[model samples]
Target: MAGSNFGTAAKIAAPLVLGGAAILAGMHRWESQELTVYADQLAGGLPTYCSGRTQPPRPVGERLTQARCDAIDAQTATEYGRAVLACIPADKLDQNSFDAFTLFAINVGKSAACGSRAAQLMRAGNREAACKALARGPDGRPVWSYASGVFVRGLQSRRQYEANWCLTLAEAP
Candidate 1:
């Protein structure tokens, strides 16, 4: 009877362990998909600042390849994801929230994201407030005004998406 009981416990425990692993794997895949979506939204290469000088421009039109653009996107996403994970506790965020925050960090710089009111709210366990805070800019103005003291439709759209993601639970892509 004892041996039979032990066998039943092992059967139950095994499924639980496997289910937990599958959930974790799904989360990882979801995070990767979010990164890819962000990269696609950002599009291909544009000159970035380096020592106050613009970096070399990427080949335009025919000279630019999808593979090359993908490589750049993947590299940039990986860097941003690492920076975000370093400063934020993974357990504190759901997949959608994590993706939104990672994108915000990518756009606004790691230090700014880490120090922002949104991050503070997240740390304080006020996720709903943090989601709302996503709409605010570094200067506490709306993101639309961050472009050039005028409302930018694109910025507003992006902020809306981020805020929505923060507020909703989304499935893995």
Candidate 2:
């Protein structure tokens, strides 16, 4: 009877494990979509922002092919993901947190993101504080503030989104 009960438990657990994996995969896919949309909005598709040389020198402001645009977008997302993974501890991140950090890093650059107060807080296991810290720049000003003291609406909106993602309890995607 004990052996039969163990087999029954295993049967139940197997489905649960598979279901959890499916859910995680779905979450990752959704997160990737969100990142692409946000990045496309930030970086227009007009001219390719290629880091390396292309076959033909694609000058700035020149229109890119649809295929080229897609390739660049995908490349940017991959680079940002790699940067976030390299800078942050794996155990400290959830999907939303990772997404938020990725966006922030993309905007502010890897050095700033890695050295941020939020990163420190996260490393110390203070997620709430880390979330709050996302609103400010490296200079301690609101992220929207320019070096000349002007505030940009777009930057403000982006910071708000990042903060919301950081603070929200729900998993992203």
Candidate maximizing TM-score: 2
Q: What is the clash count for each candidate, in the order shown? A: 0, 0
User: RMSD (Cα, Å) of candidate 2?
Assistant: 11.2
lDDT of each: 0.52, 0.53
Q: Assess the local accuracy of residue 68 in candidate 1 as a C-alpha lDDT between 0 and 100.
A: 52
Model 1 per-residue lDDT at 103: 64
RMSD of every prediction: 12.0, 11.2
Residue 6 displacement (Å), model 1: 39
Candidates in order, TM-scores: namely 0.59, 0.60
lDDT of 1 by residue, 58-163 (tens): 3222233445544444555556566666776665566556667766665667788888888877776667777778887546667522543557666666677677
lDDT tens digits by residue: candidate 2, 75-156: 5555665676677765566655666776677566777888888878777666766776788755666763342456666666
Give the range of the ten consecutive residues with the poorest summed lDDT in model 1: 7-16
